[model samples]
Target: MTSGLVSPKRPRNLAERLVGEFTREIRQARLRPGDRLPTEAQVVRRFGVSRTVVREALSQLQAAGLVETRHGIGTFVTMNRRDSGLRADAAEIATVVDLLAMLEMRIGVESEAAAIAARRRTDEHLERMRAALDEFERLLGAGETTEPADFRFHSTIAAATGNRYFASFMGSLGTKAIPRAHLKLPDLPSLHHRDYLASVNREHEDIFNAIAREDADGARAAMRTHIGNGRERLKLRQESSDNLEPRRKK
Candidate 1:
């Protein structure tokens, strides 16, 4: 197994880094099917991460169907390197540039998805979306990142489209689809974090409200605006970073 410590330079969170490392090992055949992963303590020691981070990474691997944890035994690789249909690698999508590209793609895809959802969504679907938005607001108020709730809101929208493929596509992307999950938002000013997320939740409200009204065109436009704003935010952040680099080097 690769023993290199996870790099702090990456913007990804500890669990995401761990997931990427283990994923690379599994995909590279360094860890073959049925090969047991390091015990939780061993992983914690080797990676210099908390037990929580390790468990979260392992849970993601299990959810991806790449590994399985046996009762009282250990987590073992469940599959070899093979094409898993409709998957995006977290590592590939880690950078701001990559995230921008993803947002562009989402604008095209999810915009239509929202329109379809507006037409097809049942009362149950609207309730779930409202619940997700409520959870997101609660988390934001608690000063939590709210990525899970954010993802849940988008996933619920996809599910409301009444198309399994749309839901599957969102599931495949997972919480990584939420830009702030990888953006290191804590490094920014607290005001920026709070203000930006509040803006985002308001966008979520727009999307949800449009869908609830069964206004297909309005839902599509709102989804586009939401995702398009995300792309613009990434571009602005990148420009800000680039402008700061010269000052830092001076």
Candidate 2:
């Protein structure tokens, strides 16, 4: 009979270590969409790991939708350039088409989220929403940026919908959405006309009112109308831009 014995040297656990490094780099956003990642051998050299460990780490990133490998080309940090959800851009030659696609996606998500929140919201959730709304108005009235409040408002709605996944996704993405939403809001101080903002404020109130009443149908309708109104306004703005199209116009 042979006695069992432990190995003197411990395994490096290279896969775990490589994954940690990769996760850190990706999270720091040093590796953005379309960014190329190092090759398998290159990754191994960087991590001081064997080839298998590098492959495992890369595979994990791929599974997480954080990266992709081309058949003959190198791996990329981000696979889906359309991850932003809104499709509009003028930087590229084909940006206008993409922007339209993006807006369509935003319309679908915002409308549905609103509808669902109506059916599911609780008093605590409404309180959270009101808090966010108050913060937004307070800051905006004070001639300061209200980005924090803006994020919280959307975040609260997503949470109120009783879907943890939706809430998490919104929290992750709301920072990007708010800046764009702020741009879409018509100028008040600059134009000296607050009607546009007032209108939006009313829409928000109508949404809250429906949710507070537990009027699921009303909430859905309110949210759908609100999202549709935004889309229509954006479309009209686009048409207005066409009327004054300078050569450099986005």
Candidate 3:
């Protein structure tokens, strides 16, 4: 059953978009737990994406434990037999905890990614990272959201790792990888917001500089610190809010 799963939009992030559509079907029970998914050919025709894109999308699904592909048969949903929703849930990133968990996962994957990027980055990779960093700064100055620029900056580092899978995995996480987009900590005082963004930009600079200088240990440390600080920032914000409430009540 097609279920109108097709999209006419030009291919931008085809695999991740397809993953979203498939997830909607599964969550809504349009495609139930054990039902077999459409064939690769059918998916290609419906989505107007290449076979390779379809395969990649399916591979992500398989990796998420949402579906299983047989040697010659077809891909089947694997949701109910196991806690298959974890991957889809992650991709959705619906809650604060989910976003925090995504950050933790990035800390594990991207700390090493930064180290490799530092060792492997070429002039071109450095240039791309610089461009992303510049754009982030420009957007931040304009009082605009920096989520896309932030994502590109991190993804550029992943690309510098000389591993397409690293980039692909980051791509699979999509824009949700930007914690600010998913988080709504009570607004810092205006000056505090400025300081916070400045600090964040400084962290970005540290990572970029380490990569440009080909300092693997520095890159890894910078990346770990950046993500770890973000986690703590949120945790502390939550704790402070909780502490303030009883005083306000009093």
Candidate 4:
């Protein structure tokens, strides 16, 4: 079947936009559980995106436990909205205030998790984090959606804490943990988007370096600073939007 998804006027991460479209369809009961999604080729034709983008979007849906792909068959919806008790809907997190609230929660939870991870992480955990960071950099360079890699990097840190609960908590947040994945901001200039993402990766590097060196205090500080910087950036964006509101109405 053809999709009714429409491309936005401004540029966005295509995979993320596809995910949002699929999510909306699923949540609205139009695509119920057990319904097969459009084939990857179909999706490519319908959305006018590359197969790579379609695969990435499907991978994210699988990661979120929303769909299961059967070998040689097709991807089918696995759950309805009510089945996931802890999901953070992008629609629900539409405002800057909501995003700030999420970051506030992350700052408290992740800082401690980073410290604990530094103390308890194994070689495998470090390798995973490194791979996630590498994937993040590659995707950013390719101008693809980096949300999966970003989520993987943070989730790896949580996993390194040697506590299943920490990992579970991060998994429950999923890509929603990366604010840029869903935040409803105006289209940013390409230079601005690249610079912003590069800055984020640098912060990720700091957190990784601290964890790799087993510096619990330093890791904790780095995590705090990373998340705090996100909070500040959102606040600044909010302020800028507020400043522009009057002119837009004229």
Could you estimate the TM-score for every candidate? 0.65, 0.52, 0.62, 0.65
Which pairs clash in the backbone of model 4?
none
What residue runs in model 1 are displaced by over 4 Å at the alpha carbon?
Answer: 1-87, 243-250
In angstroms, give how far residue 25 of model 4 lies from its true place. Answer: 19
Query: Which pairs of residues have clashing backbones in candidate 1?
Result: none
lDDT of 4 by residue, 88-110 (tens): 44434434566678899899889
Candidate 1 lDDT tens digits, 1-250 = 1111212345356766787888899888899998999999999999899775676566456545667667689999975423444455555664555667778888988899899999999998898789878988888899975776777688778878866556556655656677766554225888878888999999999999999999999999999999999888867666655332210111
lDDT by residue for model 2 over 1-250, one digit each (tens)?
1111212232223543565576677788877778889888787777687764565455434434456666579888765532333222222212233334544555666667767887788787788678766765775577554455555566567667766455545533323333233233322364343445446657777877887787877776776776567567655555554332212213
Lowest summed lDDT window (length 10), candidate 4: 1-10
Cα displacement (angstroms), candidate 3, residue 87, comes to 8.0
lDDT of 4 at 133: 86
Error of 1 at 92 (Å): 2.2
Ranking of candidates on lDDT, top first? 4, 1, 3, 2
Please write out the lDDT profile of model 3 over residues 1-250, one tens digit for every residue. 0011112232225666797799778878898877999998999999998765675566555544567666578889875534422122333454555566778888988999999999989897787678767877887788876666677678778767866567666655655566565445666797788678878889999999999999999999999999999888866765555322110111
Better of 3 and 4 by lDDT: 4
Q: Model 3: how far is 108 from its true place, Å? A: 1.4
Scored against the true structure, residue 132 in model 1 reaches a CA lDDT of 75
The list of candidate 2 runs beyond 4 A from truth reads 1-100, 179-193, 242-250
